[model samples]
Target chain A: MTEASVRRVESLGASELLALYEQMCLIRRTEQAAHDLFMSGMVKGTTHLAAGHEAIAVGASAALRPDDYVFATYRGHHHAIARGATPEECLAELMSKATGLCRGKGGSMHLTKASTGMLGSYAIVGSHLPMATGAAWSARLRKTEQVAVAFFGDGATNIGAFHEALNLAAVWRLPVLFVCENNFYMEYTPIAEVTAVPNPAADRAAAHGLPGIVIDGNDVAEVHDTVARAAAQARSGDGPTVIEARTYRHFGHSRTDPAKYRPADEVERWMARDPLSVARQRLESLGVSADELQQADAHAAGVVEAAVDAAKNAPEADPAEAFTDVWADGGSTWRT
Target chain B: MADVITYRDAVADGIAREMRRDPSVVCIGEDIGAAGGVFKTTVGLLDEFGPERVRDTPISEQAIVGAAMGAAMTGVRPIAEIMFSDFLACCWDYLANEIPKVRYMTGGQVTVPLVIRTANGGGLGFGAQHSQAVENWAFAVPGLKIAAPSTPADVVGLMAAAVRSDDPVVFFEHKGLFASKGEPAPPDHVLEFGQAGIVREGTDVTVVALASTVATALAAADRLAEKDISAEVIDLRCLIPLDVRTVLTSLERTSRLVVVEENPYQGGWGGTLVSIVADEGFDLLDAPVKRIAGACVPLPFADALEDRVIPTADAIVDQIRTLVAY
Candidate 1:
């Protein structure tokens, strides 16, 4: 890690700093286990791992209170865990266990817990941008102090809903934080090949008359400070902010593909800048040791093991539940 | 207790009564305030409730619907207007994705008490751009509740019911029904969602209709009575939560059926009704189901051509005559 980033995380208290490192580790370990299970056919459906993009979700989510709403994309286990979803619940969802957050109905693509104010994890590209803006606008109308955050990939910035949502949020000065996780590749297509502009998608925010902040996605302290200030500004009714975190994906877009689209040297370089290792070194420099880190790891691993066991023992989803939730009253005139 | 009231006036009364009853209800749309609605359905509302409650928004359909969704989720019941039902294509994302799916995706933690009021169908030569009966599109969305009322009373009653519901509702008002006359419905009338009113009863044939087609269906029933065919006409006032029992009862008596609609013939509400009857009451049918609906082509600007596309009383009678023989 760089000297500057090291000093930045060292500024936080021992407990908070230790918790942040452990949280990122939990995300990495849980997702790594999920990747192994998926490859071994222990799980079903498409799984998108957030291996290299941990710092963005962990850092940004640490900025807000529990009342704040967060919208996430399909690659969302990290975002969910960062927003307070337990590692076990998220891991169980990937495994399609009954005790998953959505009772296994949402699986990897859609994990939501509204009680925590985590609005949803949408499967559609860029669809949740407008939804987040709507919720932020609602918060402003109702005079709530809570702000809404929308997290998406760099590819989503090209969709029509993204532009429409950002412009509307700017025009109304809605309390929203638009975070773009620019992981270099948008499902095998390089950012340079698709976007004519720079890598960080935050550059486009200026056109909407909003401030855009670009930070080192791998640096947790920089992401936290940048997002914390932006989130504070939104809660105080100072309009929205666009943050682009430049990062890389450790794995391919899904369970398949060996990331042949990327060069061997590029992967080695990002792996050298691993977020967990960077945070651990910062904590150690601040006098937290390998023994303390091991304790946190044990705690997280225990939590995940308990959660997976509980999920496996949970009851199966009722067949009638498929018909439920479609309507508020459990009735549709079309079905007669 | 009654006077000459246009369908527009009935709608205005509906909105005014809801706003008076609940402080949470408000109106938002283009030209809905001081200028009133495009058809003046919201005239004098801003003066009575003030601009904060009766809002006029930009022509952007996406912004209008999005603002309504935002307002609805935050304890405000907003009655948003799309100016024309045809304009809904511009904001299908807000309609189909964000609004209806909000409560469900959130696992019922929230409720969207919203109403989208728009005029559909063509008769005054607005042509294709301003005219299209796209209620089927709203019906296709799972979380949305839809209704198309044919009478002044039904429109007023259904509007009140829509604003009172906890779910999002799309109220499709036919442009052609604005001037059509009917007995004045109750000023404070409340209409149930899944109930269909049998306007006229006969035994020879059953014709199911909704919205503007209800009037045409009644007229066709009168003509069929003259010819001794005795056609029974059922007005499916509510489109989405269809009153299947009423339709089944009509089918039981008539033993023959025809569906008349203003929407496109292919994959229309007619097909939906046919499938329901075919699955539930196959033995009751004496003839192949006949569907009289709008032609697949867009509504033409020419008056005669427009007339040729929409379902008319003559068209309904022709289909009923063919069904009766079988």
Candidate 2:
């Protein structure tokens, strides 16, 4: 990391640091509960958890305004939670309950809460990049200062839509932020096996004629400070910025994956740099007491427990509701 | 209040009218600006809407459709052009998987008012890569509304309706019909999606066709008059909202059905139309339905081979005569 960037990270106040730590804790706790639910067979289907990469979601989303839009990938529970989606609503949607966001139509991978500006989450890798770019174009046409953020993985940067979206955004000077959370692995394959470059941000941004910033994603202060600057630049009509956060995922790609492909030493190393623990250490060094940190952890645990309870009790979605929402005209007589 | 205009101008006029009517309407495609598009359908859109609204994009169909889908969800009506229908294969994932399922997947929380305009069909000698009648591929997708307008008037009306539609509309303009001139549609004319236009009403046999095939069917109807066959030609403006009522009504009078399409015979849209009739209006039929379509092979570049592959007016007339004889 550059000395200048490190100095900027140190500029964050104590309360902001505490808030970042609290959000990271909440995400870690919620994802653990989700993993437990999946293992217990309470949650059907596969889920990609973002336990080790919480700081990127929490920090980058904290930089945007409440009205600004966020387009996230399938591993998106953290993105939604960081953007102010209630834990109960997110868990219920994962559980396929009617009261959940998207009314249970989109479960786990496709969580959407328009009220919080968390536009739909996509499962297809790098596909949502163009949509996010389009959203930025819409903002430009409407003359709004709103910035659109696309949260994708390192794997997505290699996809055709990623390059196309970035090129379009750069050419049109659209207000969009491309955030690639480099989780070191694309499912089970190491990124180096597929991608030619060690870091995609600088080369890609240079190709598109935009500023590219890379930071230690495990550091919440660095992630927040860098994203906030990029968001401000986008809002000021300086076109898009590519931000690559170097991070890792503690769990396997999905519920069924055991991540045996990963080396044991590599897992230990990433686990040591866990974003939650990293933030907690930062808070401790900033004169926060251990008791206060423990209390915050307990609070996050309580929130996750309550969310799980609510999701378990929520009613199953109605079978007839499937026919609805297929068309906006509601003239579809296929059901009738 | 109607003037004569080419099919290209009719498409341009429809898009320009929608842009002027709604401020949120924007056009995004390759060479659609100063170059006026490959087919010149977006000839004057760049000057009228400026670059902000009429955007010339890179050769990226996935991004173009994805951007339009994203913009549509955010209250901006985007009319994205894919240059050629064959190029849709490059971004079929976005069209088949993403764009069509957004509204339904979101439980109607968001509506994609997106129009994907592309030139389809063969006959221009653009070869296999350029010329293709692949509307059937898009027709198979559930949520998409597919439109294939035959004349300038129908093109204008369908284009306007597609722009105003809340669902994703795939507007297919035939390459062979671009130069064809016809009466312009009225300023406020927006053809309802599920309604079919009966170009020539008759009683012996009902010939259901779409886009360029509609012209072929109309010519066949005229030749059938000489033979006293009295063929009915139904111009299916859009395929998604298949106008079964009109086809069924025509079938009630004419018990024989002959479906024609520019695509191949196997798994083509003609098959779907034939299946619908066979399943629902079986008792009304006097004979087995005949489907006249392109040969089941890649469209060759040679004119003689292409002519042999595509169904001509004479073929349609012969098919009708056989169905009428039955």
Which candidate leads the pack in TM-score? 2
- Docking tier of model 2: it is medium
Alpha carbon lDDT at A45, candidate 1: 89
Assess each model's interface with DockQ, reporting 2 decimals per model.
Answer: 0.43, 0.64
> Which regions of candidate 1 are displaced past 4 Å?
A1-11, A330-336, B26-35, B45-75, B94-111, B181-188
Task: Give the alpha carbon lDDT tens digit for every residue of A128-196 in model 1.
Answer: 787688678667656787888989999998887788778878877889999999888888898778897
Candidate 2: what lDDT?
A: 0.88
TM-score of chain A of 1: 0.93
Clashing pairs in 2: none
Displacement of residue B200 (Cα, Å) in model 1 is 2.2
What's the lDDT of the predicted structure labeled candidate 1? 0.81
Docking class of 1: acceptable
DockQ of 1: 0.43
The best candidate by lDDT is 2
- Which residue window of length 10 is worst by lDDT in model 1 chain A? A1-10
Model 1, B1-326: lDDT tens digits are: 56667888888888898999998888878899989888888988999999768877656677678667755765678899999999999889877877877665544556788999999887789998898999888877777888899888888899989999888889998898887766677657889886899889889888899998888989988888889989888888877777788888888998998889888997687787888899998999888888898899988999989999988999888888877776
Q: What's the true lDDT of residue B25 in model 2?
A: 94
